[model samples]
Target: MSGDAPISTPWRPSKKDARYTGPRACVKCHAEESATQHLTAMGRALEPVATSEILRAHPRLTFRSGPYAHEIVRRGDQSLYTVTDGVNTISEPILYTFGQGKAGQTYIFRHDGSFYESRLSFYKDIQGLDVTIGYPREIPPSLEVAAGRRISMDEARNCFSCHGTGAAYGNQLQLDRLVPGVTCEACHGPGAEHVAAMEAKQFKDKRIFNPGKMSADDLSQEFCGSCHRSAEQVISNKLLRGLITVRFQPYRMFTSRAHDPADMRLTCTACHNPHENPSADEAFYDPKCFACHRSFASLKSPAVAKTEEKEGRTDKACPVAQSLCVSCHMPKVEFPGSHFKFTDHRIRIAKAGEQFPN
Candidate 1:
């Protein structure tokens, strides 16, 4: 990691006493970015349960696993999560919804002053409820356990830190002051000082962290990876094995042969624009792939090859098709029980009926 790289720990206080000014303050100069970013998945990562569009739209969702029946229903402005096993029943008002529902949305509710992650989540692929990822498959021993899993204070802090901004301070979570979803300050550091400096027409000492200043490796491994799950984090957590690792893009990407620490072309921003929603159009990524993998016809030209070699762009041409490279190379693998297929970021020539690579 670069010494200049901003600390990877989310919600950690800035070196100075700069406070969070919220995303509205960022709209003054970055109107377009702020507007578009709010529409992205990262922008709506965490939402208050009462105002969740997915829950409001569905109204009611139910799932059956073993002897327990889980259900979530919208009541007036609030949503209620209930679990029952014939006789015993547990119900609570959902406090938070922890996803944008592109694939799924999990509910988090407070039970007896403690936070609990609902056992079942709404999966878009199934258009209904199912067990949340990583939850046990076996039947629960009691109604309380069937209702949801209790989470540690540190885990709750980390969850809110990533899903929302301005939620954690020091060792505590200030839920009352939490900002739902990732805003500009979440990645760029708190904007209060920057906003003040800009309003005062002082360009010098605009106190804010710019992730763009970090090197390619630092940006990939530490900056974006901090939330996306870096290779080091996955390995350290013993999550390097199985198809579940596919959801961790940075870790899978780091394992790819195309992952060159020195090459900016292989970095996350090379293909994705964080301010915008990710597009599924394969054509959109062909240019990024071609930046390194030249066309076979282009490689045959001696002059072009010589210039490329001189410019330190000597990556070999692809023997296969040119466009839609990601369709074949980065195949989507469906994780068991999640009901969603994640695009494996480990770019490679995928073979039919082959086992998933670690």
Candidate 2:
């Protein structure tokens, strides 16, 4: 038998009252929010390999990336992933499925009690397995443990902690105990005390951490930036430029002129609802921007519209395109290898045929 490994610091707060009660507890009171959140990408961020329909959708999933060949074989009740480096082969049962299969779905497999990410991912837009985002295309011949990135135990824990809820319990990475995706406790902290208070009809402070109540700087840096990389994190990691870095919305938004230090509503939650699935409609965000840029008083005026072609009625908004403000300011720029189009969060007036902003 093997000895126990050393325990690291706990991921969540050490407060005695902060215990997770799962998402079901929140459904009783916040039914609408909970129901809608369950449909979001964050809600289905992670799941067990067995629960993933993507794997079963394609019986024999295979892809070749550079010098390695990867395949996921379904064997009755189990799914086995095999990775080969031409001469060497390593096969393991797929343990977990990362992502919601919206952008992509990455697999995780265990070997020698350590977890490693599969090189190939099923991109929804592309509808095929390809090299995982930010991973090298060609793995070296010397590395034969897996046909993918061999992440450390700490890395594995961190990845799960972000993808799912209750991943870390008292300095231990308990994947089995994980709730499998971002649940109620992920953003609002643990809900055990809150549930108890609700049950007791106390109507007092439930000891739940609400990001909306935090200060502007704290809300942006510690709250939203907890998952979305903070300004400091992006700069520290040296991910300043390139299309790959566009995914770091907080860092980009922090650098934008729209982010006012004096205002609390200028944060990410201003445009995005934490409980709802993010919509792709560019016009949906125009009202959020117009709240700060243009006056609501203009919208109330029952004046002659442009569609009616009324003479002497000039619109104060953008002369060219008015409604879809995001399509012009926050243009969707395609990354080199990704099929998904990432809207630049650095809110700026983009010139036509201009290079991507640095």
Model-by-model lDDT, in order?
Answer: 0.81, 0.71
Worst 10 residues of 1 by lDDT: 1-10
Model 1 lDDT, residue 192, Cα: 79
Cα lDDT for residue 110, candidate 1? 92
Q: lDDT of candidate 1?
A: 0.81
lDDT of 2 by residue, 3-41 (tens): 112132122553433478889989989888887887688
- lDDT tens digits, residues 270-322, model 1? 98999998888999998888777666676568887776667566677778786
Give every collision pair in model 1.
Answer: none
RMSD of each: 3.3, 6.0
List where candidate 1 sits over 4 angstroms from the true fold.
1-18, 307-312
lDDT of 2: 0.71
For candidate 2, the TM-score is 0.86
